[model samples]
Target: MAVHGTVAAGFEGVCEEFASFLEREEHDPGAQLVVYRGGERVVDLWSAGVTAESLLAVFSSTKGAMALVAALLVQDGVLDLDRTVASYWPEFAGRGKDGITLREVLAHRAGLVGIDRGFTREELADDRRIAELLADQRPFWQPGQFFGYHGYVIGALVGEVIVRATGRTLQEWYEERIRAPYGLDLWLGLPESEEPRFLSTLPMLTTPEQQAELDAAPYSRFSLGGIAFNEHAPDAVELEEFVNARPVRAKGQASCGGIGSARGLAGMYAAAAFGLDGRAPLLEPNTAAEFARIHSAGTDLVSDSVKQFGLGFNTIAGSFASVAAGSFGHSGAAGSLAFADPRQGFAYAYTRRRYAYPGGAAPENAGLLWSVARALR
Candidate 1:
């Protein structure tokens, strides 16, 4: 297999396997996989027309980034995870949301699952509009009843809280505190300057008939799952287009629109594992431990299976047991995955330009990642 860049110390084999996997998969147009051990990058490899400089839209992997920012605020006393959401953003009290806590929101237990109504691209850009819809919308389930993945709404809820606490958008706060100081290339809200460098994600492979079945399915929780947004809305072009637009981009919806190289994502997890590179610590050891604590573990109402969740990160068990118990990370919509194992003191990130099958059950990608981690162990 051809290796494109430097591999972390003692992890060259891991990168080799990763490169080979990408080649064999073929469906992956481009990809970057990065691993860090003991606060140092041990496996940083790019292959198949991808490079360290390439930026891919990592779907829900953005949630981990959002969680990191929220954890930082909690550490700095800027926000309290246990506090009621209404305490900070009083308007969140509307629509029986007075009891929702930051912990619940992060854990996907705050019944604000899906917006009861459709939102235009204009509404998505308007923070006030997003918040108003959330405030007025009824919960899909009783609050704290069960976990329903907050697909798009999680970003808005978390972003609104961050704004109330810091008076800065999540993107601004993240760029200034996490991205710039740490020298990371990740962006929560992409800027016009970076737009040219952005790689357009390949469209979903599902046929129109498959998409129709997905849309008509009663259990479909993610609004973006199967419907052709542009055709339905007329104004929306593609899901990515709406997600990456300036207004929505400015809000930094942490659930969907994070753009960065795998190295950038891995580096952030590495910082959490080993502290910032010779600078102030991003998270205390105990803070990281707390962040990794399991908050919910059961059949996720949205994902339709028993999965584990911490405050903002997801825990792996059963079928995902390959990832280890203490390991913390999140998987994006398609196949993007980012994880950090404190036990091994390793952080790993993988991103692809193309969308694979929806559920990451295949052995090619997830198996390859687990294989690399196992090799290091």
Candidate 2:
């Protein structure tokens, strides 16, 4: 295994072992894993073609970043979670959504799960168009009644609210408040100069036989299988277009499209765990406590599996039992994982270019992370 970076103090052996594990798993391409314990980085490692400078698209892991942005605003009294989102962005009041609170929106309980309006890649770049579409859309379920993962809609809702309250787009606010303060390399809206460093996500594999089997399955609530994200045969050309295009990168979809190194992601969580660079708290103690309170603890409507969700981050029970119980973070579509354990004062992040394993359970990269976490304990 080609280890590419040094592990920090007290964790050199852990890093070496993780790199070897990755090699044994045949995890080709690049990946990074960073762990910060008690305000000090103890495990900072990258392997294969990954580097300290390499930044991968961390799909839904961006949700944690978005949640932090909202938490900061809430900390400063610029936004109130209990207040109706319409209280800030009045247009959001349309379609019987006036009762939806910022808390509910962040908690994925606002019922704006799947927008019926089909969005082309181009339409994604226009925030106003997306916001308008979201404002007019009806709830998929009773607001605050259940949790349906709002794949893309939550970003529009939260971003618009942030803009209305702070006079800044979510990306700008994140840069000024979070990224700039910490000198983190994370970018919500990737700049053209950084385009060359970006790694495209491998398309999810699907075959004609698989599609036929999926089509034959009965429509039931508990059924796990369904049409893949790319329903047609895996088209490499379209996959490349989707990942490398500017429209996708510039869209500022907070649920995804975040570009950052694993170190940067780990650093952000470190800042969240401790304070940001010796400044005042990014989130007040009570606010963080409130945010960590689990809101839903059952089968998610979208994933059709049991998931424990806190205010913004998913909880560490059920399938996430391996993670520390109090830990909070988000996982991305293909294998990216980031988490913060306030109890241990530990924060870690792992980002990969190639999709290692499929489905909800953590992949080989995550297993290595768990091993390191256990060793540190």
Candidate 3:
């Protein structure tokens, strides 16, 4: 398979590694990888079925963008991290959740994963509807006592807080403050004009053995993990189908409704951490440091896996040995990963059109990221 796009002279290894990964794949992953080294894009590469400009649905990676918005508000004194979420959104106080702080929510410890009945596809597309549905529901755990990957509803939970505090939605704030200013293609809400650029994410192609493993795994619609992903919903949509719908893209649910390319993902982090195109970085050093600090580290009750969360982002260093300890970003269900390593002075993003087996930051990222890191070093 032929790879397209250019890499900076020193980063030829990243391009080679990307090509090798694609060559090994049994199918076209339709992947794109972009790296920014301190405000300068050092690598831009894409595999077959996608161009650098093609926008793809990046699942939980959307959470990173949401977290960035929250960090901005916290930095601007518009939202206080320590303040109880109920203090801003009174309805959120229902069901013994009055003490959960904004900080805890960002750390995935607020325990408002999803409603017991689950959400319809339409409800999942609308953040306001989701917030209303969950406001009075019971939390799965004691507030702030443990952390879990909230998966689907975290954005609505956090977005509700944003609405009550700033009188605006997370998508609005993101467009005005982050996406528009930086001209980043990463979008909280994708407009119709941009719709033509989006390519629907393809499903994972698993082997018979892989299918058997998936089938054998314990899963129930009512389980914590199931509910977190909204599998409990009567009209639940598959992860790929959820974002493929036009309504979901238009509303940009904030959790997994994000649509963008590797450039857009890399640009957003670069703008936040290193400034893009000569503008000053959107986040101050202290702000970036605070968000990147590991807030939750342990076995996640929902996913039942050991994970490290820095605010809303996965601590990239923990998952990828090549990155620095302070690195932070979120990975998508479709094998996309994007983050900034402030300590190492680079921002990196990788997106794949086809879902990778066993999901969440495709295994290829381990080698690809290592190549990028090695080049930088």
Report the poorest 10 consecutive residues by lDDT, candidate 2.
224-233
Please, what are the lDDT tens digits per residue for candidate 2 over residues 1-377? 67766666667667766766766654464678888875677777777666788878787788888888888888888989999999998888888898999999888888776455355555444555667777887876789988867655567678899889878888888888888888886778888888887777654443577567656854532221111121122221232235456766766567666888888888888888676556654666677777777887787776676777777776643345456666777877667788787766678788777654453324665566556666676
Any idea what lDDT model 1 has? Answer: 0.71
Candidate 3 has a TM-score of 0.98
Pick the winner on lDDT between candidates 1 and 3. Answer: 3
Off by over 4 Å in 2: 27-29, 204-242, 359-361
Clashes of each: 2, 0, 0
Name the best candidate (by TM-score). Answer: 3
lDDT, candidates in the order shown: 0.71, 0.71, 0.90
Query: Of models 2 and 3, which has the larger lDDT?
Result: 3
Model 2 lDDT at residue 108: 83
Worst 10 residues of 1 by lDDT: 224-233
- Candidates in order, TM-scores: namely 0.87, 0.88, 0.98
